[model samples]
Each structure stands twice: as C-alpha cells, then as structure tokens.
Target: MSNPNEVKSTLKPAYDHVIVGGGVAADKAARAIREEAPDASVLIISDVSDGPLYRPGLSKDLWLKADATLEGIDLGTTETGAELLLGTTVTALDPEAHAVTTSDGQQVGYGRLLLATGAAARHIDTPDDDRIVYYRNADDYRHLRSLVSEGIRVAIVGGGYIASEIAAGLAAAGADVSVHFPDSRLLEQMFPDSITSHLAEVYESKGISLNSGFFLSSIHAGRRLTLESRSGEKVEADVVVLGLGAVPNVQLAEEAGLEMEQGGVSVDETLATSAPDVYAAGDIATFSDPILGRRRVEHMANAERSGDAAGRTMAGTRTEYRYTPLFWSDLFDDGYEALGETRTNHRIEEVWNDAHDAAVLYYLDGDVVRGVLMWNTWGAVPKAREVMQASKEGRLKVSELAGQITPGG
Candidate 1:
C-alpha cells in the first residue's frame, strides 16, 4: 500500500471512473466497470492501509486462529485494473466540477463517481485504555488476538452477532468470557424471546457469563478494568470488547448535496444518485428494492450484487439491482442464515426438529411472509426465498407453506 501523504505526486489528475472505498463493494464495482468498458481508467480510494479483503473473516476465521495474519485471510487478487490509493482519505467532493479533493490537497477529476464508503463501528462513552477494543477492522482483530490467552478475562459489551461470535471465539480459546447487553435477551431486535432463550443457553453452556438488561456506565482501568453498569452493578475484566452497531459513512454524500433517505445516500433502482454521473452502493446506499421497497442493506451479499449493478449502470449498461440479500453467522456449533426483514414484532410460525437443534422461522406482516430465518439449517435458502416471493403475490397460504417445510426436512 502506498502512503497517500507521501505519494500525492503519483496520483493521476483524472480518471474515467473514481471509486471512494476499498471494501468488497468497491472491488466488485471496479471489476464490473472493467468488464463493461475495458479501456476506461479506474481508481479506488480507501482509508484502509491494506487492499480489499473479506471483512467478515476478521470476526470468524481470524479470531478462531490466534496465529492468523491478515495476509492469511486475503480474498485474493482483484483482476480489475483500478489503481488503489490505500491510506488515503477523500476530504471534499465537487459534483459540479466532477472532481474530489483528497486530504493531501490533491484534486482528482472523474468522468463517473462511486461512493462505497461503507461504515464505522459505533462507540460508547467509556474511557480510553489499551485493554479496550472495538471489533471492526483488521487492526482490531490483530489487537484482540494478542490479548486472548488461557484464563484471560474478556467482557464483551453488546448483544449483536459480533458480540456473540467474539464471545464464543474467546471462550473456546480458554478465555473467561462474559457478555453484557442492555436488552432482556440476545438479538432482541431480530429474534423473539423464545429463539433468544435457546441462543443464550448455548452461550451459557460454553461457560460464557450472560449479563443481560444492563449496559456499561463507566470504565475504570487499573490492574484489572472495572466496568460499572447503569444500575450500579459492576464486573471486573482484563479487557473489554465493544460490539455496538455501525453508522454509515455518509459525510461525502451529504457534503456533495446528494439526497438522503433513512440515514444513507438515496439512489434509484439503477443505483444512480441524484447527482449526474454519481452512484452509491453497499452500506452507504439507500436504494430502491423491487420487493422490499426503499432500504439500505449492510451485509456482504448485498454489497457484492449492488456494487456490480451500480458499476454496470455507471458504465452505461443501465442495469437494475433486484436481488434479495441473505446474511449468515456461525457461533460455536450453531448458526443461522436469514433473508428479508426479521423484526420480532412480526407474526411468526416456526418448525423445530425432534432434537430442537434446528428450526425454520417464518415472519409475516399480515398474511404476507416478510422474512425467513433458518437456524442450523442449510440448503433451504432458495426454497425460503421462493416461499416469500409467492407469499408477497398472495399466491401461498401460511398453512400450505408450513406443510412444505417440516422440521425434519
């Protein structure tokens, strides 16, 4: 990776397409653009010191292998001829002039622009300390790997998937792990109490202390860090891991006067922003979904498909993004893959196996199936998606759908 500050002179004055992110979305978009127009020049500007790699691996594979280096989890080479400007930050956007200014005061013009800026980890009000870590990028993974040892005390703050995965990983690695969250149950927003209970039990069985219905109020670092809850209860730990959610990186879009929707840059079905020749994809784009209406998806599958669509559209192919995104996570011996919205308030119908080890949950908004969650169940995603599509068109009854997917099947 080239140093953006020192290599300012090496940057080109302009490019046919300029992408301002270095995640999966940017990589896919660059590849699509090259496929559509082989002769066009493409450049990718990213703040990450390393080039594009699988972000999800940082939480799963990298954490599981304490000796794993960032190079070991590389997503392989991007065949796109896009010049990557690593360790670089875009400071200003000039839509009218079709150009952007980097932190080093370098003005680079673009015939077409893409903002796949992704997101940043949300933080809490805890005091600064070497033992405190927010799980987000490659650097965080490396730092946490160094801290995990036999009997090492780890307190994870959050009830989301990241927290669950980290707690499971650390616990399996012989660390004394505890999970603290403000919710009454784990994954409260996505799963009902019944499902969350099963998940919590799994963590408890693995020797992970479950601290529910409380959030960290203060952090005092000393020989061992003391974390006080809002209700005055406390727990001491050697290190703290924050799994708070993320906020989309929308400053560039906001400054450029692009329309915003639901905390992201609003784009049409073709993934084109309001500004001429400008597009947004991945977590930063609040795009129009053919089936789910207007929404922004932060998962990896959505980033890949949406970025490809946006790249094709930018290259004058006039493509429309119309795929449903599915996100999956594995923790210990359990995992789930889900598509569509999985809100807890929805009417749910579930089928559990004889051993209660696997289940399929159907979320309904009125008589329409809004989402499907397959717990420890694989090879059912296609069927689930088909069921949802059919339900949306008022073609399938809930009872008929339930009969199709028995617990054993």
Candidate 2:
C-alpha cells in the first residue's frame, strides 16, 4: 500500500461539469454526465472524507443487515472517470466567471456547473460540542457506529424520519437509545397519529425509549453527559445525537444571484437554474412539479432521478424531469414506500387488509388526491404512480381511491 503521506492530486485547470457537494445527488450527477458525454471532464467536490455513498442505507442496512457492506454504498466516482476533491468544501462561487473557490484555497473553473450542494442538518442552538452529532451523512454514520458498544447510553434528539431510523438501528446494534422529540409520537408531522403511534410502538417494542414533548434546549457535558430539555428536565447519556431535519444549502446559490424559492434553488422542470449553464438538483433544488406544485424532495430517490435529469440536460440531452420519485424506509419489521406530498395536514384515507399488517393511505387536498403511502405494503409503486396520475388528470375522485392501490396488488 502507498504511504499514508500521499497527497491528493491538484484539481485540473477546469472541468466540463463541476458538481459541488459530495453526496448522493453529486454522485448520481457525475455518473449521468459521463454517460451522456463520455469524454466530459467531471469533478465532484465534497467535504466528507469518503466521497459519495448510498447515504440512506447508513441509517439501516449498513448497520443492521449482515449482508450490507461498505462497498455496497460506494458510488464509484472513479469508475465514472470523475475526479473527486474529498474533505473539501466550496467556499465561494463565481457564476459570472464560471468558477468556484474551495476550502483548500484552490480555484477551479467549469463549463457547466451543477450545485448539488445538499442540505445541512438543523441542530440545537447550543454551542458546538464533540459529544453531539448532527447525523446527516456517511461520516456521521461511521463515527456513531464506532461509538456504539454494550449498554452505552445514547440520547437522540428528534423523532422524525432519519431520527426514528437511527434510533431503531442503534437500538438493534445494542446502544441504549433514548429518543427525544417535540411531538408526542414518532413521525407525527408526516403520518397520521394512528400510523405514527404504530411506529412508536415498534420502537418501544425494541426497547428504545421514546420521550415525547421533550424540546432539547441545551446539552452539558459534565461528569456523565447531562442533557436538559426546555422544561428543565435533565437526562444523562454517554453521547448525544441530533437527528432533526435538514436545511437546504442555498447560501452558495443565493450569493451567486440565482433565483431561489421554497427554501431551495428554484429550477424549472428541466432542472436549470436562472443562471446560464448552471443547474441544481437533489435536496437543494425546488423544482416545479406539474401535479404537486413546487416541491423540494429530501429523499435519495429524488436526488438520483433529478441528478440524472440535470446531468443529461447539462450534456446537451435536454430532458424534462417528469418522473415522480418514490421514497422507502425500513423500521424494525415494518416499512413504508410513498410518493408525492405526505403531511399531517392533508386528508388521509386508509384501506387495510383484515390482518391490518398491510395498508394503503391516500392523502388528499379536498377531492384531489396528492399523495400515496404503501405501509407495510409491497410491489405497488408503479400502481401507486398510476393512481396519482389518474388523480392529476382529474379522472379520479377521493371516494374512488379505496383499494385503488393496495398491498401486493
């Protein structure tokens, strides 16, 4: 093996496509750019020491599944012939000059720029501490995994999507996980109380503590690790983990004078930003969805699909991103796959089997169906998409949605 002192290669004078932020979206964008323009010089810039990866799996499969390997999550940027500047951040962007300055003080130009600079985790307003983890990425996964041992008390803040997954995965891995969130139930903001209650039961069944209405205000690392919620209640843990949702990394795009909407870079159906030859995808891009209005999807599926579209369009393939992406999550023995908008505010309709183990939930805005959730249901994403399309076309009504898309259908 080469010496550990080996230096990273200097970035080239310029690249045809320079994608900022090394995550799933950037990885997918690089692969698509190479596929469309085989000879294009592509570069991916990421602050993570180990470049792009299947980030979603780090919360579940990489930790719980015996067959899951680190190599399985690798996006293989080298195989795509894309140069990677790892452990580096894009400090500045110059859209007018088609160039970017990185944290390492290297300036590079690009023919076409794709700002796939994903979202950053929202953290408590307390001062930074080593005992805390924002827990948004692969590096965080590795770090947290390293800290896991028998009976280690871990305090996890937030009970939303990533938080719940991390809590269950850690509990399975033998960590004493106590989850704290403002909501009374897990995923209360996304799913209805009944399903979210089911999710809470799943976690409780696994010996994980669910602390509701606990607003974590500050963490003090004393003799043992004291975490105090807003109500003056204090709990001690060995380590603290933050699993709150993410805030889109829009500062770079905003500073470049690119138009922004809905808390992310505003892109057309083609995924092109207002700036010439500049585009954005993944969690940082809020694209106009004909059926769902404008939405910025944070899941991996949207990143992959949007990255593919942005790459092709950047390479002169001009593609419209009409594909509606679906997201899935595995929790204990149950899981969910859903598409379009899923929120607590929408009217929800559920059709369940007699066993109640499988069900399909329809989320509607009045008579218009806007989203679908296949809970513990399998093999019906395509059918669900067709259902949503029918709703979009005005051919389907809310009353006609029962059994439209259900388990194993």
Index of the highest-lDDT prediction: 1
Report per-prediction Cα RMSD to one decimal. 2.4, 2.2
211-323, model 2: which lDDT tens digit per residue? 99998878887766788888999999988888878999999899889999989999998899999889999999988776677888888898998998999999889999887
Which runs of model 1 end up more than 4 angstroms from their true locations?
A: 1-9, 65-68, 406-409
Task: Give TM-scores for every candidate, taking all chains together and pairing residue i with residue i.
Answer: 0.94, 0.95
Q: Compose the digit string of candidate 1's lDDT tens values, residues 54-133.
A: 88888777657767657765554245767888788999989999999998788999999999999988987877897999
Whole-model lDDT per candidate: 0.85, 0.84
Model 1, global lDDT: 0.85
**224, model 1: CA deviation in Å?**
2.4
Steric clash pairs (candidate 2): none
Mark the 10 consecutive residues where model 2 has the least summed lDDT: 1-10
In TM-score terms, candidate 2 sits at 0.95
